[model samples]
Target: MKPASKSLWKKSVSGRVMVSILVSATLLGTTAACATKSGTDDAAVGVTDDVIRLGLLSDLTGPFKAPAEQQNLGIQLYWDQKNADGGACGRQVELVTRDHGYDPQRAIALAGELNDSVLAYQISVGSPTSMAIRAELEENEIMAIAMSWSPDLGESPSLVVPGTYFGAEMVDALDYLIEEGRVAAGDKVGHIYFQGDFGEPALEGLTYAGEQNDIAVEAVQIDPSITDLTAQVAELRKKGVSAIFLNAAPPQLASVAGLSEAQGLDVPIVASMGGYAPQLLDTNIAATLEERVLVVGSVTAYGADEPAAVAVRDLYAKSGSKVPPSQMVVLGYAISAVMDAAMEKACADSELSRDSLWKVFHGDFQIDTQGATVPLDYSTPGVSPSSQVIVLRPDKSVPGGLEVVEKDYAGPTVAKFLDR
Candidate 1:
C-alpha cells in the first residue's frame, strides 16, 4: 500500500515554521468565511474549501541548498501576497515541503510520501531528480512546476518549466556570440558541462548550432563532485578555443573563469542559466565575471524597473529579509506566478482537480508576471512557452547585480531547435 500522505506533513512543517505561522494567520483571516472540507473529500487530491496544499521538493541539504532556500522564500512570498489579497476560490495556499538533497532516490521517495497530500508540486529541483519521479507524477495525474531546464521534461504533460530549456539557451548563446563577432564560422568553441542529463541538452544545443554555423565545438565534461575545473580550462585553452560556453553550476563557472584568467585565456564566456547566481558577484571572480561573462535566461533580472520586478523588490523588502533577493528568488516567484494563474483559473471554473488545472495550463493561457519575467504561454505540450531569452551582464552598480544586455533575443538557432 502507498504511504499515508499525512506522514510527510510533519516533515514538511518542521523546516518552515516561521513562514507557516505567517501563512496560517493570513489563511485563517482570509478563509474564515469559506466552508471547511477535507482535502480528499470532493474534487482533487489536495484541495478543500478553506485550503489548497502544494508540495515543494527541494535540495535543502545538497549542492544547491542555498539557491533552493532562496527559491522557497520567493514561493512563500508569492503565496503570502496572494493569500493576503484573498486566496483562490476562497481557499488559502499552503505548502508541503520536503528536502531531497538533490538525490534522485530521495526525490522519488518523497514524491511517494507527498503525492496524495498536495494538489501540485510548486518546485522540484534538479534534472535527474525530476526525471526519476516524472513517471509517478504522470501516473497520478499530478501537475508539477519543475526547476530543471532539461528538454526531455518538456515532453511530460504533467510537468511545466518556467524558462527555456538549456539546449535552447545554448543555441541562443552561440547565435549571440556569432552575431557579435566574438566567434566566426570556422572558429573553435569549447563547451564545459556537467556530465549527465543536466548538461546533455545544452551539449545538443551547442552541437546543433555548431553544425548550423559551421563552427567546430569541443566538449569537456565535469563530474558534479569535482570542485576544481583548472584541468578542464587548461584543456580547452590548449585547443585554441575562441569562446567558451559553460553549462555548469555557478561555483564551477566561477572556478572556470578564475582559472581561465590565471591561464591568460581572455575569450568571452557564455553561461547557461545554471551559471547565474547573484552571490557570484561577491566572490573574487567578480571582476573576471564583469569583464567576460554573459548569462542567458528566460526571466528578467531582479533589478529591472518593470512592474514584476518592482513587485519582487517590494515583496523582499516587506518580508524583512536582511540580505537582498537573488535571481533564484526571481525564478521561484516566476514559477509561483504561473502556478497561481492556473489555480485561479481552475477555481473560477468551479473545479479544482488536477485535470482542471491541467486544462487551464494547456488552454493557450498567457502568464504575464509584469516584467519579472517574459510572458509564458502554455498552449502547446512539449514545447517552450517562449522562444526568446534575455541576456544579462554582471554589473555591480545594478541593484540585482546584473544588467540586461538584450531582451527577447530570438536567435535563429533556437527557433530552429524549437521547430524540431
Candidate 2:
C-alpha cells in the first residue's frame, strides 16, 4: 500500500497550481494531499489568519436536545482537534455553535447569526429547523453540512448544502433485510409513522421501492400527541405484516417496539435513518426495544469501524460528555471531515471565503468513496433524494456502541411499499 506523504504542505501566493498528477478519485485527492499548510482570513470578521471560522446549529436546549447536544460534543471536539493540528490548509478552524430548539423560525434567526459570524454551517437536528433557515442560508452562500435525512434537502442552493438524507437510506435498510433473507420480496411490510412531512417521505420511498421490487406494503399512523402506540400495533398486527418500518423518533419508536414485543409479533422491525439509539434502547420500554430494532443511517454512527471513526473516539474521550454517540454525533465528525477536506483544498488555493468553501464542497468530497460507508454522491444532482444508507443493530458487546449489520444496502431504502 502507498503511504501518505508528509503532512508538511508547501505554501505559496502565486497563481493556483492544478495538482492533478497525484489525484485519486477514491482517495483524499490532491486537495488534502498537496494542500499547503496555509490559508487566508478576514480579520474584520474575527477570522484569524490561521483559523477557519465555522458554525454549528443544534437542538441543544429543545426537544431534540439529547441528540443535538451529543452532536455539539462531537463538533466541538472536531474543532479542538483541527485547531490542535493547525487546522486544514495550514490554519486553525474555530467552530461556533448555537441552540435552535427544533423551531424553524429560531433556526432562521440562528442561520442569520451564524452567517454574520462564520464561514460555514453544520446542523445536528430537525426538519422544521432546516426548513426555516434554508432561504437565509442560500442568500449568504454558506456551505452547510447536516444530519437531516429529508429527501428535499438534496436540492442544492447557491449557498445551502444538504447533508445525509432519508429516502435513499431506507432503501439501504430494506435491501439489507432482503439480501439477508430476513424478509422475502412477496412479504407484507408494515409502516408506522406520525403524520408529518418528515415521516411522509419514508412512506413515499418505501412504496416506490416496493413497486419496483415486488413487495406488499401496509401503513399505520399514530397521533404524535399520544403517549402510546398500542392501538397502532394492534392495527398493524391485524394486517399480518411480515416486516415493520418506522419513521418516528426514539420515544415513539420505543413505544411501538414495546407494544410489538408485548403482542409477541416476531416480524423484523426496521427504523428510518434516525430512530433507535442508546437512549431509546434503555427507555421505560427498553426491554422490547432491545430485542428487535434496527436503525438505518445516512451517516455512520460514532462507533464506526473506520478511520474517521477513530478520530471521533479520541474526541469523545476528551470532551467528557457521557452520552453515547448517535447519527447526530457521528455526522458531526463526518461533516467536520468533509469541511476539513474542503478547507484544505480551498485554503491551499488561498480562497477561504464562504463562496470558495461552497465550491470546494461541490468539488472535494468523497464520502464512502469506495463504498466503505454511505457515499455522498454529489455526482448525481439532488442530495437528499439520492443519499445511500446503512443498517445499525444494537449490540451489547460494544459498550455504548451499535453494530452495523450491513453496508450500502439498498433494499430497505425503497419507499414504495409504504405507499401501498
Candidate 3:
C-alpha cells in the first residue's frame, strides 16, 4: 500500500457503502454486501483484499521493557484469537510493530515510517511520545490508542486512551484513602511526583482533591534520575502527612515504602498505576507495600473477580506462555479489544479507510470490554470516556501481584476535576 495521502482517502471514499450498527448475525449478512458495493480493494491505507494492518508503537527495550513485553504478548494473543475466529470483516488482522525504546524522538521517527503502512496505531507507549506525535497524527488523519494516561491526551481527537488520566486517578486515590479512615479532611497530604507529564498531572489532581476537602497538600517534585526518597520522605514526615501519594516508577516506590517504614512515617502510600510493578513482591519492600501501598487506576486489576478479568487470565494460562502475571497484559488485551471494535465498526460502515476509522473513534460509540475495564465512550472530544477507577493493594497470591480493593470507584472530586 502507498503512504497515506489526501488523494488516497478521496479515492477510497469515492465508492462507499453506508450502514448502521448490526448484530453478529446481521453483520455477517451485510459484510459481503458492503464489499460487493464498494467493488474495489482501494478502500484505505493499511488494508488490502484479504488483510487489515494496524501499527503497534511499543517500548520493547526501555525503562518499561518488562511491562511492555507483557503488553505486546497480550496484543498478539488478542489478534491470534481474533484470527482463529475468522478475523474482522473476513480479513486477517496483522500488527506492524516498531519499538521506540521508550524514547520520544524514536517514537516520532517510527510513526513517520509506519504512517502509510497501517490503518491506525493500536499502541503508543509513553506520555511524552504520544504528545510529541500528536500533531502529526492529526495532520495525517490517523487514529491512535495511546497507552499513557497523561491528561494532555484528551486534547487530541485522533488519540483514544483507555481510561481516566493521571490527574483523576490521583483524585480517586485520595478519596479511597479518606473513605478508608486513613486520611481525613483536616490532615496534611504529601505528594512526591516526577516533574514531567506523568507526575505533574497527578499533582494537579492531588491539589484539587486537597482544596475541595480543606486538607493541606505538600508537594515534593523530583527529577526522574533521583532514586532516593530519603529527603522527600523526611520532608513529608516532618509535615506529619496523613497519607502520601506517589507518581514515580518502581524504584522510587521502593525508596518511599522502605524509607517511610524505617523512619516510622506511618501512613497509607497511595500510588498512580505507574508506581507499582508486580516484580516488587520479590523485593525487601514487599511487606511494606502490602501493608501500606494502594495502587489506583482506571484499568481492571489482573486476577480481579470480574468475569472479563478472569477470562483474560484463563486465556493467558491456556496460551502456555512462561511470562508471569502482570496488569500490563490485561491492559494490552483490553485496549486491543477497543481497537478491534472500532475497526469492525469502520468495516461495517463500508469505508475501512483512515478517515472512516478516525470518524469511528470520535463518533458516538460505547465500547464494553465486558468488565476488563469500565465501558468506554469516545463520542465527546476533550473528555475521558469514563471516570471510574479501581483501587488495588499488593498481594503476592494474586496472579497480577495486586488485588482489587474497590472495583468501581469514582470519587466526588473526579467529576469536578474533569469538568475543569
Candidate 4:
C-alpha cells in the first residue's frame, strides 16, 4: 500500500500545514516534560495512556442491515490489522459499536450515551441518523465519519463523508449514458427513486443533468417500505423512457430490472451505489441484472487489481469469513482506512482530541487508499474528494458479481452539476 504522501500535509492548505507543523513541533518539545501528565487526562475525551476509543453507530437490524453488517465487519478487520501492527501510535484502538436499527431516535440515545466516551465516531450509518445526532456531536466536538453521502451533510462541521454524494453519482451516470450513445438529448429518461432524503439528491442530479443535456427527465417515486416495482416499471415503460436511472436499494433494483424485463422494457439501467448488492446475484433476477444493470460509485470495485483491494481480500480471508467480499465490505474498509490515517496524524501530533482530528481531517492530508477508494481531499468543505467515478456492470464471473466497465470515468455533467 502507498503511504500518504508527506507533501499533501504541506501543500493543500497552507493554514492547516502551519497548524500541524506548529502543533507537532510544540508537542514533541513537551513530550518529555509531560510524559507523566495526568491532570490533563480529562481534556482528552477518549484517550488514555494505552488506548484510544472510537465509536461506531450502525444499523444492524433495519432495512440496511446487510450492508451495515458487512461494513462493521470490514471496520473490525481494519482495526484488527492496525492493532496487530502495534496500533496507532502507542495506543491500541478500540471501537465501541451500537445498533441504531436505522432509527433517528435510537441514534440520538446512543450518541448521548457515547458522547463523552469516544474520541470520535468512526461511522454513522444513515442520513437521518446522522442528522439526528449532528447537533450533539458538534456540541461535544466529536468528529463523525458519515456513511450517508447526502449533499447537505457535505458541509456539516462534525461529519465527514468519504465518498461522492448521491447527486454527483447520478450526474456522472447520466453523463456516461449520454456520452456512450445509450441515451440522447431530448429523450425521456426515467428516474425511479425512493421518496425521501435517500433518493432526493439523485433526483436533483438527474434533473440537473437533464436540464444541462436537454434530456427530458421524469421521476417515479417509490415508498421505501414497498418492494414490488412492477407498476412503477410499467408506468416508466408507458412513458417510453429510453433509459432508466434507479436510486433505490439492492432488492428494489432487482425488482425493477426483473419487472422491466418481464414487461419487455429492455432499456439501459443505471443505478446509484446503493442499487447493486452482491446478494442480488443469488436471486432469480441475477441474469437480468447481469444484462441490464450498471452501477456507479466513488470507490474502486472489490476485485480490482489494486493493493488496497488485495489487502481487503486477504484480511477477510485471514478472518475466516466464509462470505465473499462485496462493495459494502470495500466501503467499510475504505472508511476505516481514511479515519485511521487521520487518527495516526492526530497521534503523531500527540493531540488525539476532536479538535485535533478535525484539524488533521481538513488538513492538506489526502487519504491514499492505494486504489481502494476515490482519493479524498477534505480540505474543501462541501466539495467531494473526487467527482470522478468507477462504472461497473453486474457480471457473475466476478467475486462481487460486478466488474469495472470504466475506472475514474469523468464526463461533462459532473462539473456542470457541481458548479450549480
TM-score of each: 0.88, 0.83, 0.91, 0.90
**Candidate 1 on 166-274: residue-level lDDT in tens?**
7878888899999999999989999988887668888988899999999999998888677698888899899999999988888788888899999999999988877
Number of the predicted model whose lDDT against the real structure is largest: 3
Q: Compared with the true structure, what per-residue lDDT tens digits does model 2 show for residues 181-245?
A: 87777777888876766677777667766666687778777666765888878878888887899
lDDT accuracy of residue 12 in candidate 4 = 30
**Better model by TM-score: candidate 3 vs candidate 4:** 3
Structure candidate 3, residue pairs in collision: none
lDDT of 2: 0.61
> In model 1, which range of ten residues has the least summed lDDT?
15-24
Question: What is the RMSD of candidate 3?
Answer: 5.3
Considering every candidate listed, which one attains the maximal TM-score?
Answer: 3
How far off is model 2, as Cα RMSD?
7.6
Candidate RMSDs in order: 8.1, 7.6, 5.3, 6.5
Question: Which residues of candidate 2, in runs, are more than 4 Å off?
Answer: 1-46, 158-164, 283-287, 368-373, 384-387, 412-420
Give the count of colliding residue pairs in each prediction. 1, 35, 0, 0
lDDT of 4: 0.78
Candidate 3 has its poorest 10 consecutive residues by lDDT at 22-31
Query: Which clashing pairs does model 1 show?
Result: 308-370
* Model 4, span 272-309: residue lDDT tens: 88877888888888888888889998877778776777
